[model samples]
Target: MSAPRRPVLAGNWKMNHGPSDTARFFADFLNRLAPADDRSVVFFPPAISFAAAREALQGRPDVRLGVQNVHWEASGAFTGELSVAMAKDAGAELVLVGHSERRHVFGETSDETAKKVRAVLDGGLVPVLCVGETLDERNAGRAEAVVAEQLAPVLSIIRPDEVAELVVAYEPVWAIGTGVTATPGDAASMHHAVRERLAQAFGREAADAVPVLYGGSVKPDNAAELMSQPGVDGVLVGGASLDPGGFAAICGAAG
Candidate 1:
């Protein structure tokens, strides 16, 4: 059977641009896109630039806009945080949660990530949840277990049917921005393992429907081989995504 067909090419801008830069990136990238006939392309800009990116994508049916992050609460005194409602209002159809930087640098735990995931769905937006293992964990032979732990909390809250609306990104901590990438076979292996874990946690149908993306040092050069993997439905591009031509190249490869 052909691999499940939910391929999403998402740009995780991380902490890259301001509102002006966001607008430029969108204009340049969206304008150059030939027409997304085979895959869905989503751009996750910094929270502050969501409105700008939205405006940039105005009337552009081929491109979609998403947010880099969202808070679990609808509204509260959480200073310096963007809430789910705010993200929706800013025109985000999807929100990224549990990225490695957030987990490692910002001290966000899986429980918090789960809350954010629930919030995104409740707010009528899809959550591109990220889950992966560190090099130490992989070296210690706990890769699957670590990923399972990261997924357990979210699974406890969301139903199996809800999996179709969600996208998962597996980005090994050590590989991200380190000029290191998981070999195509290794990436395929982990992706398969992730799908199996999802099948066990939810059900076979949900697992098969859910799209698992491989992220971490993804560039245009290796995009095709990575996308050819059995369970790698898409990519969560980072550094390469900051450049319009580079990101567009990767998306074109997905086709």
Candidate 2:
């Protein structure tokens, strides 16, 4: 028999929630759901609320806390930047790098993202690396090339054995928050391609073991179909995750 796939459901609470709001959400969320022992569930909040999230999740073995972004430095005078050490101090077990918004809005280059990945891993935090293609690139038949390019620099920094410690989310730029989800077939195709690239870069065993999640408009209703795909390991939920019950349902589907 095949081993059961480990499911990861991460909530990217991008730019939402203050300290008080963070506390309230966790209070309600923890109270409502059973502990997620069979799967891994993460909450990725903005840099400002990392402490609040840490405080709330302390001693709670059920959930893992994550950070939306982290600078590729141990410590520095870089103004308004949160370093990997700072994120670790705040209790983040995972750090998100190369998110679509970070790439499109903040202009984070792949080289910088690679540095951040190394920083996070060196600091003992897992990195959730985001890679995908823009609508323009997809229309121009460059979707695969675009994603491959994004993965190239990061692959150079980490070994195949290290890939399992990192999570990759394939979120199409056009689908994020636009309420348009990629068909399961489309998502599976890209996920398979990503696995192929990993195999070429790191070899077969490492490629098959790495978990690649599908993000962009993922909700309870569509989660099962996406999960049914061979290469899809889990989901990176956005708006649906704001509600504890809704997110719980998505996790249950993964289960």
Candidate 3:
């Protein structure tokens, strides 16, 4: 059998943390974090702070740095947007695609996500594809369908072996930044559905190799339980991750 997939604890700093703050955050975080080979820990800082994060993570190659977003094109007339090559130049090893805020707040579409996924892959960067439903969709019992729709296009563009370079993060819009978290069972159920969808697209073996993460209001206190659920390979942290100590504790829970 192939080796078990490693748990990934990813922190999405979002719009917070400037370069100096990024440096300070990692200084404290790395101090608190004990080196372990059992899991992976990644930080998705803002594009501007990539340098500081990379410098802070100099000796620790196991802790990776990622870009919050990347444009599909290698170069463009588009201003204020960084392309995949630019992101790679900025030292990002992973790119977040289709985050809920990118969709709801900025109107990013699934097709756009698919393109970005392809670009990141071609650029030799991993894509942490975020998929989930809003509160209303979940209430209507259309959560799984919505997630499927989000994944279908991207799945079509990726080969089965490429699944190894992909990570799926389920971040319910209602739960994100609302202080409301889905119960472990709820997250696991959605993760299972996501894995099933991947199985259909890439076969069961490839699907099982993908690391499906549960996000949205995940905290140090509940992180262990969330990661314990079946199909929950890890977590995508937001506000709770802004705190160095708290994020370290959350990473510890991934074990």
**Which predicted model would earn the best TM-score?**
3
Q: Tens-digit lDDT track for model 2 on 1-255? A: 012458888899998888888888888888776786787889998777767888888778778888898899778788988888887877778988999999999999999999999998888889999999999999999999999999999999996557778788999999999999999999999999998998898887778777889999999899999988989999998988888888888888985
Clashing pairs in 2: none
lDDT of 1 by residue, 208-241 (tens): 8888899999999999899998989989999999
User: TM-scores, in order shown?
Assistant: 0.95, 0.95, 0.98
Backbone clashes, each candidate: 0, 0, 0
- lDDT tens digits by residue: candidate 3, 90-146: 788899999999999999999999999999999999999999999999999999999
- Candidate 1 versus truth, CA RMSD in Å, comes to 2.0
**lDDT, model 3, position 217:** 95
Q: Is candidate 1 or candidate 3 better by TM-score?
A: 3
- Report every candidate's CA lDDT: 0.87, 0.87, 0.92
**Clashing pairs for predicted structure model 3, backbone only:** none
RMSD of 3: 1.3
Mark the regions of model 2 whose C-alpha exceeds 4 Å error after superposition: 1-4
- For candidate 2, the per-residue lDDT at 227 reads 88
